[model samples]
Each structure stands twice: as structure tokens, then as C-alpha cells.
Target: MISSVERVRAAYARIAQVDRPEVWIGLRPQEDVEADAASVDARAASGERLPLAGTVFAVKGNIDVAGLPTTAGCPSYAYRPEADAPVVARLRAAGAVVLGTTNLDQFATGLVGTRSPYGAVRNALDPAYVSGGSSSGSAVAVALGIADFALGTDTAGSGRVPAAFNGIVGLKPTRGLVPVEGVVPACASLDCVTVFARTLPEAERALALMAAPSGRELPALEQRRPGPWRIAVPRPERLGELEEGWAEAFGSAAARLAEAGAELLEVDPTPFIEAAAMLYEGAFVAERYTAVGTFVDGHAGSADLDPTVAGIISRARDVPAHRFYADLERLSALRTRALTALGDTDALLLPTTPGHPTLADVEADPLGANARLGRFTNSTNLFDLAAVAVPAGEVNGLPFGVMVIGQAFTDERLVRIAGLLAAPPVRLVVVGAHLSGQPLNGQLLSLGGRLVRTTTTASAYRLYALETVPPKPGLVRAEEGGAAIEAEVWQLPPEGLGALVAALPRPMALGSVELADGSFVTGFLCEPAALDGAREITSYGGWRAALPSLAALPSPAALPSLVRTEGPGLSPPRT
Candidate 1:
């Protein structure tokens, strides 16, 4: 396997080969990245468990990364942060190495990626299209494989829009679920640190790490159980205007989800549309002003600001304080109405953007194109909901994406659903110690595994109680007359299989195991020699059922290997 350091070096080489300068505003020196990777390697050598060990990542320029200057996509507004943003710090602690800072829409004020003076961030797949912003570069970096994942800020669909344009996963966590300290504010109260990655599990891993510290005083997030999900979407007429092929794209995506077993229902979108309009058309415009109004006022009529962004922030000054308060009242009522509309649905599915516009299209009518892109997304943060943007399919070779929105704290549920929609996962049948709730289950979860269902193997196997410390179970194929054995089937990331298989203890190997349904999946199997004199517990059906008697015996520490081997049927230890 290539070491993490080699991967980082190769990523930088790829970036150099492509030479897309506009995708990044600043990058750590090669030596700096090497140093970070070296530190992660040293930690691994010291036996530390780093969830993101050797993972390379980037940050949207607005979020601080100690040695990098945070420009928020405006050169004049740049400032060198003395420390990393809390999100960055958390990711670093988890062993992710920082590659650099990426470009964005100036001050995070637009959905089109062209507002930065640093230069327009072109689409990763095509140079003629807009990359979407203010997370344009972050999304492009991930799409181009320059980084494993990246951090972006989402105030008004910045994170999600870019993700759609780049065919990547954009996770806009529930507001305040990730601390915003040390990040350059876009709309302060509405701003959320977002994650951009190529897969749902990668995004989920980053979200979990960033969410840990901020969850202290927050309401406990509900753990999502796997089952058939009910998905809500806007009624056809209310889906608003979409680009030429986008409506069909969305319809096809909805149909596929239905075929995959999700129950799809249409709901009136009036409240959500009204709430979305309030973000800029209502008094919430002032929030943008509050974040960077002073700077705009100070730099008024200067060439430092992007005209579109300048015009947007300049309008905030006209919104009176009383208007802001009234809008807040209106928003609260709308939120209640929106929640009522959602009812029992697990999540709301929508097009991430109405269209993917070209650079010329955005330049000709910047505000109109940007507004259309945010039609389905602007309401999410305003309503304090969590959303994930996932690539749905392609329209005439261009990427089309669907946004999965859920009520507050349902981040994990959204990712789980997104994963199912994106691709078929690697299913593994886990028995014995690796079953759910067993001591070794963490190994599966840490490798991005999700429990699919509990089932029993076909009646060709026998279960034996292993006399190892911690007392694991071993399943062996029988020549004749064996009982069915219970097992848990888990879906794991295919890329993690090699490492997982490499870590298995003696006698345990991955092999085809047939389930009661007559289907087969790769699962744990023990060598026949390992089960010679082990106690047969096939009648119990599963490890959980036999756990009680095992728990009642003298602890493994109190009983030596000799005592365990003294029984009548016990065989001598093998070399």
C-alpha cells in the first residue's frame, strides 16, 4: 500500500500537472504538508488511533488555517489568523493533513463562483462553466482528487451549490453543530462550516469529528436506524423553473429512489419558498451587512470589491432594525409551518440547483442565475435544518445533484440515505466478535460500515466457542448435519476491505458465506484446525444467546490456558 505521505506527494503532483491556479488561493508549502504527514505517521508509530490518519484536506479560504491568510475571497479583506479554526483544529487532531486554502465567492456572498478577484473558479469537469460558490475551489479540489475532503462555509447554498457543480458531496451541517470560531463570518448567525467530499461516508466522518465538541450543550441528536425511508419533495408545479434538462434529471432521480424502496410524497412548498425569499428579499439581508458591512462601507467605490457582492451588501444598509425584527417573527411562524408540512417524512429531496450555468451565462445575468441556483437551498440554514448535497446523475454529460434536507440534528440520517442513492455498497456478513454490539464492532464502524440487517447463515455451518481471551466465536463449515448460525450483515466501504482483512486474527479469514435467503456474501470463516476441540454451541444459533453462560464462568484472566485445555474433549494447543 502506498503510504499517506506518498499519497500527499502524488496529489500535489496531480495538481501541478493540471495547473488550475484559480482553484486555490493559497497552499501550504510542500515541506509543510510533508511535515504534517510525518507527524501523523509518527503518531501511528506510537500506537495512537487517528480516525483520519493520513487523510489530505483543504479549507475554504474564509476558514482559518494558522499559517495561511484568510481572504474570504477578497484580497483586501485578507487577515492572517493566529490559530486554526476550531473545525480545522479538530480535523487535524483526527490526523487529517492540511493541503492549503481554496478560493471562494468574495465574502461568501454569491452562489456563482466568479465573484472572486483571485479569478473565476472554473468547473472541475469543464472549463467553460461556473464552479459554484462561495465554496467553488473547495469543491473543485475534491473533484479533481487534490484533497480527500475540504471545509467550506455555507450561508446561502454556497457549500451545496458548488458540490452540485463539481459532482461531489457537500454536507451543510445543522447550524451551530460545528463551531464557527476563527472563521471569517458570512452571515454570522446563519453561517455553518460545511464539508465537501467525494463520498457520503467521508463527509460523515468529517462531520462527526467537527460535531463532537459543539454537541456539549446542544440537544442530543437522534440516532438513525436503518430501514425504509419516507422522502418528501416539492410538488411538480412548485418545483419552480429548472434548466432545459434538469427537470427530467430530477424526475428520473425521484423515480430511481422510489424504485429503491423510498416512499416519495409531494408536499406544498409555499412555506419553504416564502422562507427562502426572506433570506435576501426579506430583512435577513441585514445579517450579511452585519458580518462585512463595515468593510464594504470603508471600501465603498473601491476596486477591491466584486460589483455583484458590493451591490448585495450595500442593500443591507437600507433594511431598518424594525424590519429585521418583523422578518424574524415571520421566519419563526414559517418555520413552524414548514415543519408541519414535513410531517412524518425522514427527509426532503430537492434539486441542488435549478441549472448548471456557464461562466458567460453567469456574467450576463449574475444575480438572476445565482438566485435560481439557490431556490431550493436558501431556506435550509434560515430554518436551521441540516442538508447534504449528493450527485444524483448527469444531464447531457453535465453533473446533476440532489440535496437531502432533514430536520435539525438528522445529519447522519441524511448521509446514510445519500450513500444508498449514490452507489451499491460492499456487503459483508459479520459473525462472532464483529457483530453489532460486540467488543470488536467499533472496528467496522471506524471503517465506515453500517449495519444492514441481522440474519442467519444457511444450515451448513456450526458455531464454536473459542477459548481465547475475550471469548470470540468461530464459525466452521460442516461436512454434514450443521445448524444455522446467526450473523449481522454490514455494508462497508469497498476501499477499506484490504485493511480490515489484514487485521483479522489467526484462523479468521474472509470467505463466501451463504445466508438463509440463499444469497452469499464475503464473511468471517475459521480454519478447521482452530475448531478441533472448541465447545459446540450451534444449538444457541448465535453468540449473543450463548453469552450468558460464558459470562458466568471464571474470568479469562483467572483461568490459565492449562485449565481451559483440561476438559475431556479439549485438545492440546497447536503450534
Candidate 2:
């Protein structure tokens, strides 16, 4: 493990090397940050299991840090909180050093990063593009290698949009899940504390820490909804607004998900689209106004305030109370329809944003372009859904992404789906001792191997009883006469397969094995030389059947001391 003090210094060094000054609004003194890191190292050295030890994180400025002023991107409205937000406190307790507060759209108002008074947060990939907001700085921080993860609030795509732009993982968890008590809410009721990380597992790790009960800890292995997943996607007709390469990019992403074992189903995009419009076009702005409009109004005409943010909030003051109720009623109905459309589907997959917009694109028509960025994101919080956005592929040379939105409490489901999307599971064929309930089955079990199913190899291999220590079988391709041989198909992560390969004993190796179904998989195979003087057990069809032949056999080469003769009672060789 890296020392936390070194991690802290490395993060500061990265921040200094990056050109985007707007990515951070306030950075805690390096010495102070290093002191916190040293403490984490001390605890870890003393035998404490600090999950986040040596990890660095950045907090969105809207969320309060004990010493840094909560600017919410408006300097005049800044306030120094005496204590860290409950969410921040939880992360700190877990041993993550708070590097500093990052920039965001003022009061988390816009999807476009340009609304911040500090300056537009530039995309880490290419400065010409807008770093999506109001979580822009947080995403950029992770993308720039400054922090392992960063905390951002998501009311409407604030967490996810920036992640797409920066090619990172953004997790906007179930609403009301992460405590938002100390966050400067954009739409208080809809806001969720989200995390931006370079990868999904890291985001899951950090968010798991924040969302676990005060006393109820998260399980070591998260519960995952297994695939083949039933996934829903928007109807093609409704995607007219996607930029030139985005539609194709999304199509490719969906195709890849299908290949990863997700069953794709098309759903009308109407309900979700309409709900998204309501976030800004309907009465939801009333929530935003209620959240921070008072301050914006009081500081009216101040050049320090972002005018677009002021105007957006200012207009909500005219919305009748009845209008807010009516919209709520409308949203209630839309949630039902949206959920219904997504019925039985493990997740709803969509482009993270319609397109990647340039910094100039936002500058030219800030409101319009910003609204478009939330086209697929706004309805998420409104519908009370959990979402995980991950880098998909590039479009027109710019990074593109897809979001897997799932029902509340399906955060782990999204994680699973995203993981498959990131790295498809590998199939491995196991035979002989590696079969379920067999002597060496525990090896695969300890490697996180999942049984896909029991099957048989093609009628082209011969099974032989090798005179090895444990009396193992050697499977070899028959020159002419052969029959199907029983084997089990297993699934494993790519890394697990690699580990298994590296640990295989001599004479046993992995090679292409044809299945009875005309399919091929990487499976356990033995060198032909191993069967030179071995007893052919081909008629038995499988190792399990041939085991009866070795019922009275001793572990000759393995343990000569324990070898028994005709003497009846002896610790029999493991069957």
C-alpha cells in the first residue's frame, strides 16, 4: 500500500501540473493535508483496516468542508462551516484525505460548466470542450489524476454529465441515500451526493463508504444482479437530437452490452423525455428557487453572480404554488409511466448526454446547450432512480459514455451491468478435478469462479487415467475413435483466469477445447505425453464415471508413507 503522505503530495503535484485553474476553488494547505494523511498511515500501521487509506478525494465546493468556505460557486454567498458534511465526515473517517473543494456551476444550477463565477471548468481531455457541470471540477480532478475520487451532488445530471465529458465513472446513487444535509442543493428534494472516480469499482467503494448505515456496514462483496440482464433503451425515433457521431456511438455501446449478455428491449422515450423537460421547462425550478433563489435575488445586479443562474432561479418566484403541485402530480404520473416502460428491465441504457459540446458551444447558447446536456439525465433524480455513468467509446474523436439507470436500491445492479460493459466475463471449461463437488473444486471456488453449466466436450477427445500423485485424468484429442466427454463450463473475470493459468501444475494446461455444441472455449487440457503409458478410460465418458476404477487405489506418488496394501482400514485416498 502506498503511504497516505506520499499520495497527498502526489495529488498536489498533479494539481499544480494541470492547466485548468478553475477545477479547484479551494485547496487545503499541503502541510495540513499531509498531516491528515500521516494520521491515516499511523492508523493503518497500527493494524487498523482503513479502506480508503492512501486515497485522496476532492469535494465539490457546494458541499461543506470543515475549514474551506462553501462557495457554491458564488463568492458572496460563501460560508465557512465549522464541521464537515456528514457525507464528507464519513469518507474522512474511512481514511480518505480531503485534498480540497472543487468548482461547480453556481448553486449547482447548470449542466454546462460555464455558469461558475470562478471560470468555466475545462474538460481534462481537450480544453476546447466544456467540462460538464455542476460536477465539472470533481470529474476533471479524477481524470487529471489529482484524486482517486471526488464528491459531487446530482440533482440533474450534475454528477454524470461531467463524468462522460471527462471519460470517468460517475455514480449518482438512489435519491435520499447519501446524506445531503451539508450540500448546497440545486433542487433540494432531488439532490443526491454522487461520486466521480477514474473507474466504477473505486466509485462503488467510496459511495459504499458514504451510503452505509451509521452502524450498519456494507458487505464485503456487494450483492449483484446476475445477467443475462433485460436492458431497455430509448426508441430510435426519439433520438433525433443526438449529434453526428453520438447516435452511432450509443448504438455501438448498446450492441456491446447485448454481446455482454444483456437482452435489449426498446422502450418509448416519451415519458423520460417529458419528465426531463419539466426539470427546467416545468415547475421543478420552484425547488431550485426555494433552495438558493433568495440569496441570488438579494445579490441581484452583482457582477460576481452568474446571470444565467440568477435568471433561472429568479423566474421561479413567479411560479404559482399550484403550478408546483400540478407539476408534482404530473411527475408522479410520469414516474409510473417511466418505470412501467422500464418494466422488468435490469437497467435503462442511454447516452450520458446528447453530444459533447465545445466550450464555445456553451458560450454561444448557454441555456439551450446546457438543457440539452440533461436530456437523458434530468429525469433520473425526478424518477428516483439510481444511475451509473461510464466511459463507453469515443464519438468524432471525443469521449462518449452510456448511463445504466436502474430502480432504486439497484445500485449494485448498475455496478454489475457497468462492470460487464467495461469487461466482459470470460468463459473457461473445467474438467476432472475442477468439476463441481470434485477434489480440487475448491481451487476454482476460491478464485471467484462461477459455474455456467455442466456440458460435454465434442466427440473428439479421449480420457485416460494418468499415473500422477493424485491419480488424475489426462484429456487428449483422439486420432480417430472418440466420444463426448463430460465437462463443466465456468465463468471468471479475466484476471481470475490469468491467476488460474499462472498456478496450473505441470502437465495441465489451458487450450482450445471444442464443445458438443460446435462452440470452443479455453479449457483445461493435458499434454499428450502425459498419456504415454496411462490407462485409457475412454469408454467411461468422464472422470466421475472412471473414478470407480480408482476406488481402491492408493496415492502412490503423492504419499508413500500413507500408501496401503490389501489391509482394509486406512485413510482412503480422497475420492
Candidate 3:
């Protein structure tokens, strides 16, 4: 391992070599930063266990870092912090060295990195393109290997879009999970202190150190969702207006995640997409003005203020409190609807942005270009969801990425699901009680089951309603006159599945169920003995379609019978 001083020295050396002036807004005198690093080495030498010994990182200009001016990208607004923010203080205590503060959109108000007087943060890979923002500089510093990780803020896509463009990891923890005590807020209630790193481990390590132990009002959620994970994504038809090569890139990215053992469930993205629009277009922008409108107003014609940013805040200042409250309620409803659409799924995956925008693209139409960039990102914080953006590969030779989103406080678990995108898939088919919203559906959700898609069996099988206590289905291969029967293919981890097999009761058995697409998966089958006088329901196509006929049947003394529509499962379908 390199000494702290050596690591700090190397970071400065790389910064010099990269020669990206726009990337940093301030620097702690090199000697002073190295002195801090030297102390870290001394502590470690004295047998201290420093978790981040020799680790060097950068802070977004908007965050407080004592001795360095917090310009937040506008020189007129710069001020020296008396001390480090709690998040920074925590990281520093763990033996990490702070190189300096990086540039950002003035007051962290814009999604595009261009809205800063420090000049547009050029893309690390292609200077002509944007680096993504308002975390622009921090992301570029990490992508260039100048810092092991960097701190940035995300109220909208500021933290994620930049990571997608720079080919690194960006973790925007659940809102309020990381304290915003000393950081400048674009939206006080919505801002999050985010981490950017080269890999998942590094990002997770830093976040683990800085995160508040637990006072956030998050529900008790699982961190490790066992495999055959369900990953939600925008339905193909809804992925509107992509750059030339992005559609194909999204398709390939989704396909790769499926290969990682995920069941890609294409879902309606209406609530999320609508929420994204609200972040900037509705009363939400009022939060940004509330943050620094007076200062910008006082500096009216100062060159330090980005005209685009000033214009946005100026317009937002007049928005009445009623509109903000109305939007807040609407946002609340959208959040509920969004999570409900997810059902038992683990996370929502999306292209970090429509595509990488060139500096020229921003110049042509700053608001339009910036708005387009946030299409996939702006909704996250508004809905109070945690997100991670990782490289998905390339789009027309530019860096691209996909974000995994989950309920608030699922940071660690979300990372686990993000990692499981590479696990081998374990597909299973269910014909009756096991189908989605059925009486027995919770059995699958408890074991981390995911609905791959609602499909049907080949035209060579018969589906029968077996008379079990609570009723079940028996799928039998037809000798003749076979008809296609509806079925649902779900995925589960090997262990959870093995347990189900061990607990199999009566004549119900597991066998290969071929789908209409000719794909075979482990599904429910019936023993000949259990088929005695069973009613054939293949004519109904699926159990859901035939459920009306079975509604009158009484549930067993212990187990409830299946209900029509979505049933009473561990998680009912969100309305």
C-alpha cells in the first residue's frame, strides 16, 4: 500500500497532467494537504487501524472543506468554511486525504455541468462532450484516476449522469440517509451527498463510512434480495426520444443484465417519468430558488452567476406555496404508484441519460439539452429512491450506464441487487396458486422470486384445476387435442428453489414446462393420481382468466383461497 503522502502526491501529479482547469474550483495548498496525509501515515505507523489510510478524495465545491473556499462554481458566492461538513469529517477521521474541492453547476442548480462560471466541465473521455453534472468535476476526477473517490451532491441527476458519462460508479444514497448539515442545498429536503468511485467496492466503502447510522424514516427493508432477481425497466415503447445509438445500447444493456440472472420485467414508467418532469418544470424548482435566490438576486448582473441558472431561479421565485404543496402531494402519490408498479421486484434500472451531450449541444439549447439529459435521472430524489449508476458499456463509442433504484434506506441491499445482475438465472414456471396476485404468490416473494413475464405453455399441454384444500393447478402433457395454456415464468435462487422442492406436497411436482416460445423452465406438474376427475381449464387460457369460477370456493381453515384480480400477497400490487 502506498503511504498517504505518496497517494496525495500522485493525485496532484495526475491533476497537473490532466490539465483540466474547469474540473476544480479550489485547492488546499499542496503542502497543507500532504501534511494532513503525513499525519494519517504517522497514525497508521503507531498501530492505528485506519480504514481509509492512503485514500485520497475530492469534494464538490458546494460542500464545506475547511481552509478551502466553497465557491460552488460561482466566484462571487465563494466563502471559506470554518470546518468540514460531518460527512467530510467522518471520511477524514478514517484516514482519507482531501485533495481540494471540484467545480459544479453554480449553487448546484443545473443538471448540465455547463451552468458554472468555472466554465463547462469537459467530459473526461471526450472534451467536446459534457462530463454530466452538477457533480461534474468530482466524477471526472475519479474517472481520470486522480482521486480514489469523490464527494458530490444530487438533487436531481447531478450525481448520476456524470458517472454514466465518465464510466465510473455513482451512488446516490436514500435522501436524508447522509446528512446535509454543511453542504449547500439546491433543494434542502431533496439533496443527497453522493459518492463517485472507480468500482462498487470503493464507492460502498466510502458511503459506509460517511452515512448516518440510522435515524432516517426508512421502512425495514431487505438488503440481500436472494437471486433470480426481479429488475424493473422502462417498457421499450416508453423509452422515447433516444440519441442515434442509445436505443440499441439500452437493449444490449438490458440484455446483459438479464444474463446476470435477472428477470427483466418491462414496466410502465409513467409515474417515474412524470415525476422527473416535476423536479424542474413544476414547483420543485422553487426549492432551488429558496436555497440561494437572494444571493443570486443580490448579484443580479454579476458575471459569476450563470445566466441560465439565474433565469431558472428568477422564474421559480414567484411560484406560490400552494403549487409547491400540490406538487408535493402529487409527488407523494407518484412515489407510491411507482413502487407499486414494481410489485415484488428488487430495483428499477434505467439508462443514466438519453445520451451524452456534446458542449456544442448544450450551447445550441442549454435548457432543452439539459432537460433531455435528466430524462432518466431527475425522478430519483423526488421519489426518495436510492440509486447507483454503473457503466453499462458504450453508446456510439461514448460511455453509457444504467442505474439501479430501490426504496429509501435500501442502499446496501440495492448494491447487492446491482451485483446480482451477473448471477446465472434460475427460471421457474407456475400455473395456478403460484401465479402473480394468487393466494400462494407470497411464497415466491418471501424467497426473492421475480416474475419474468406472464406467458403461456406450448399447445401440447392441459391445465387442470386440482381440488386441494385451498385449490392448486395440475399441468399435464396432452396425448392429443392439446391446447395452449397460460402460465407465469418466475425466477428464484437455487437455495430458495431447493427449499420449495423439499417442501413439495401431495401430487404437485416440478417438471420442465415448455412455453409458446419453445423455452422450457421448471414448472408445476400433476401426478396421474391427483388428476382423478379434475376439471380441465386450458380453455380459459390461464388461471387468472378462470379465477371467477373458483371465487365461490371457500378457503381452507388455515389458508385463504385465491381472490379475483390481485390477491392478498406479501406485497399487494400498488394502485
Computed on alpha carbons, the lDDT of every model, listed in order, comes to 0.82, 0.82, 0.81
Candidate 2's TM-score: 0.72
lDDT of 1 by residue, 88-131 (tens): 99999998899999999999988989999999999876788899
**Lowest lDDT block of 10, candidate 1:** 562-571
User: Which portions of model 1 miss their true places by more than 4 Å?
Assistant: 213-227, 425-575
Better of 1 and 2 by TM-score: 1
Q: Which ten residues in a row have the lowest lDDT in candidate 3?
A: 561-570
In terms of lDDT, model 2 sits at: 0.82
C-alpha lDDT of candidate 1 relative to the true structure: 0.82
In model 2, which regions exceed 4 Å deviation?
A: 214-227, 424-575
- Per-candidate clashes come to 0, 0, 3
Which residue pairs in model 3 clash with each other? 223-413, 260-421, 260-422
Winner on lDDT between 1 and 3 is 1
All-Cα superposition RMSD per candidate: 14.9, 16.5, 21.9
Q: By the lDDT metric, which is better: model 2 or model 3?
A: 2
lDDT for each residue of candidate 2 in 94-172, tens digit (9 for 90 to 100): 9999999999999999898889879999887678889899988888888776787899989999999999998778999
lDDT of 1 at 440: 56
